[model samples]
Target: MGKVWCVGISPTDPRLVGIEGVTFHSTVNGCDTLLVATNKNGLGGISALEDNVLIMHESLATATAKGLHRMVVLGDTSSLEGRRWKVHAESWDSTMGVSVNSIHGMGQLIVEVLARSAALKGMQVILIRVGLATERNINRHLARAFTHSSVRLESFKDSKIPDLDAWTAMCLDESGEFNSEISSEQWAPSRED
Candidate 1:
């Protein structure tokens, strides 16, 4: 049977020494699968596994540093929107807190992540962002990056609010239909929107 390894890194403590021993144990056990989760700022450490799942908490650059040569990344869809927005949302609890600098930084980080992932041979990469209400032109940016990098990019809509804000708004619109329909059912025939 193949083994699996899981590592978690907190932004407050990104030192590998905090996770290395456990990660090493999993590797020595012949673990064929590895899962890593980190906070928004935690870069953690260089990953030794060739095939694994990378979950970036704060920075995509950190995840890219793993240099897996081939692997998949699982994260909230909004991860590409820029860390400023995330920081604002966390500190202020409002989406309006994102700054232009943070958005630009996030964009660059995303591009780097995609480019690095593409460089790996026979590597499959998947990026997931949460609460993607509006692609807000992100698609065009991503399209260009993927085209130049020759990497496969796939996006899904998630509407779980702050937890999955990376999802496109179209997805949320579709979900809203359910609520609209319910409201309509409770209203008079003449009260349609």
Candidate 2:
């Protein structure tokens, strides 16, 4: 099958590794994100995506609010490799503390995990942060993807968390040839203390 890919840039960790085909370029996003491929064609017409590509999940970029939202799915780059997106939601617990909701919120911690996934498990984790015109636009799409049934909530240790405040919101990370999917479901807030 043909391969579709994300064509963007990142100063923190820029470089599409492992993927069989990919042409590079630059962008202005300062944060890590898990971008749902609404359209590989929308990927800005890179040479790699000019051929056979598999359509995974909804694209947060191209998909219309009425369109992609209907599907209620953001992205699903899952593949044979262990690279996968364990979708989860955000929640707070008395004993465990605050649980991170999305991988995007994980930031560099997510990057560390993806690197480990590729090296140790031999799989890639798809990452994307919506770099639209404004934060409002980005949050709109995130808000939709966040609540999708696919996403769920889980627990994480404080040691692994780089900065809970860093993720005052949600986002995504990783790219290249790897299996990554969106984590959705409990995108709501908890009144618990």
Candidate 3:
């Protein structure tokens, strides 16, 4: 089975680890929201969040080049003017409490970068929005941001927030390579807290 990466705020959701093809990766660390502004010159904020997103894009791109064919992103979504979408990242500094950063051109940048990678074609990318009681429209708007990209996009709003097993099942089912034998407990935490 191809390697699958679980990325986002809590990418290492315990349920997702130990699965045969799943691995956890974090792009940001205590920030509650990762807001991607709609316009190029939208409200400007700190570069820390934007930098983290770029790093994420780079990591995924490199992994794609290395034959990673599946990805599951866990986060909440938000949109501006009903056009652009944003994702949550880990806190840049846990000591500072939760922070909010407004990044312009995030949607376009995500698409443009990922779409440029020939290795990402046919990749199964799943965006699992983790909040339940919030609005769902933003999720769709966020999902649409990648509509024209090379990768196959699937977005779901999980109110109850599923575990690693459910996420792995979704990725494997999408990739048509589910293996029932691999136990979720077989994998250990790879990142330090």
Across 73-188, the per-residue lDDT of candidate 2 in tens digits comes to: 12222111222322331321122222333332232233333322332332212223322224343334444333322222222112343321112122332232221122222233
In model 1, which range of ten residues has the least summed lDDT? 177-186
RMSD of every prediction: 15.4, 17.2, 15.7
Of the two candidates 2 and 3, the one with more favorable lDDT, higher being better, is: 3
Tens-digit lDDT string for candidate 1 (33-124): 23343224433233321112233322234333443322223233232334454533332222342232343234334533543344243333
What count of clashes does model 2 give? 29
lDDT of each: 0.29, 0.27, 0.32
Candidate 2 weakest ten by summed lDDT: 71-80
User: lDDT at 117 for candidate 2?
Assistant: 35
Q: How many angstroms is residue 133 displaced in model 2 relative to the true structure, after the best TM-score fit? A: 24
**lDDT tens digits, residue span 20-120, model 3:** 43233443222211222212323356453454456457656565555544443433322111221213322111112212233433443353334334223
lDDT value, residue 36 of candidate 2: 27
Q: Which candidate is the best by TM-score?
A: 3
